[model samples]
Target: MKYLNLALLILFPVAWFAPLLRAALLPIFGMDEISVITGLQSLWGSDPAFALLVTFLAIFAPFAKTLGLALIHFGLLSPKTLPALHILGKLAMAEVFLIALYLIIAKGAGYVTIETGWGLYLFTVCIIVSLFISHKTETS
Candidate 1:
């Protein structure tokens, strides 16, 4: 777990930056664009319900994890921060994976034609690495 956490910590920074880096290079290099991974693009063209969905997910998701982390850090919960971080990271990854799955399925079904944006791949990698790190560091 500790090793995983360390790996996550190292990868997390990379993931965070990968999307931006890809975005910068894609247009210049003339790469085909695709669905969004972690930015406002996901919100674009979404229905009104999407706004509510985003709000609910955004608030509740981070709140739970951040609260748990706070509890542990402030002595309200366990002394370690790994569990909270891991669980939060898991939640984050689940959401990203689901979105990616949805996009892939949509494209396969002809509902949408994705263009393979570099940001999506980078974001996916980021979430996966974060999950691994969180799980590695998590403790009972």
Candidate 2:
């Protein structure tokens, strides 16, 4: 379990950096892919406050949760810290994933062409794995 958590912890960042969505404005023109970093940057230009909130929830929260889990797993942190970390992890809901899915479906429902990319799937995997580990640790 420790090794699995460690592997996921390392992979999370890689997944975060990958492109999460791709959309084409016109069939003749080309598709533009957006990663989490790029999406946040774009959001910042349009809405700073929203972007900041997303950064805290989608990026910092998960990173912190993973780090906290690792520390607890290795006995670097007391088990007493587990509940706090668990709450933090819960607060780190996968808003980005839901947003991306919404955009894809909503746009596709119209005339736009949008598709989910590997990054979104990878990000989803990270969320699920992290949640699973947290639940397992809590039970054990």
Candidate 3:
């Protein structure tokens, strides 16, 4: 279990940097793909506040949670930190992912083609594994 947690700690950032989504425009004229960072940057041009919120939730929050967990796992941080970290983790909404999926489905309803990228799967795995690790740590 310790090893699993450590492995997931390493994987979370890799998943974050990976391409999370891909879209193929009509007639194959253009193909676009984005990672979380790129997605946030793109959104910034349109809605800065939404983009900032997503960035905080999707990027900063996870990074901080993982770091906090790692500290706890390694006996560096006090267990007292766990409660606060847990709350933060709970608020680390994956709404950005849902919005991306909604856009894909809505667009593909008629004209566009969207592909689920490995990054999305990887990031999701990170989230689930992290949750499990957190629960296990908290309980034990």
Would you list the clashing residue pairs of candidate 1? 1-136, 33-115, 34-115
lDDT of 2 by residue, 13-132 (tens): 887789887877764687888888888899899999989988887788887888888888999988788888787777666665566666857596665678778988888788778888
How many residue pairs in model 2 have overlapping backbones?
A: 0
Q: Which model, 2 or 3, shows the larger TM-score?
A: 2
Q: Please, what is the whole-model Cα lDDT of each candidate in the order they appear?
A: 0.48, 0.80, 0.76
Mark the regions of model 2 whose C-alpha exceeds 4 Å error after superposition.
none
How do the predictions measure up, each by TM-score? Answer: 0.48, 0.89, 0.85
Ordered list by TM-score, greatest first: 2, 3, 1
Better of 1 and 3 by TM-score: 3
Which regions in candidate 1 have their CA more than 4 angstroms from the true location? 1-49, 52-79, 109-112
How would you encode candidate 3's per-residue C-alpha lDDT over 1-140 as one tens digit per residue?
Answer: 66777787678778777887677667377768777778888889999998888888887776687788888888899988988888767766464466466666757577777666788888877777777888888999
Highest TM-score scorer: 2
Measured on C-alpha atoms, candidate 1 has an lDDT of 0.48
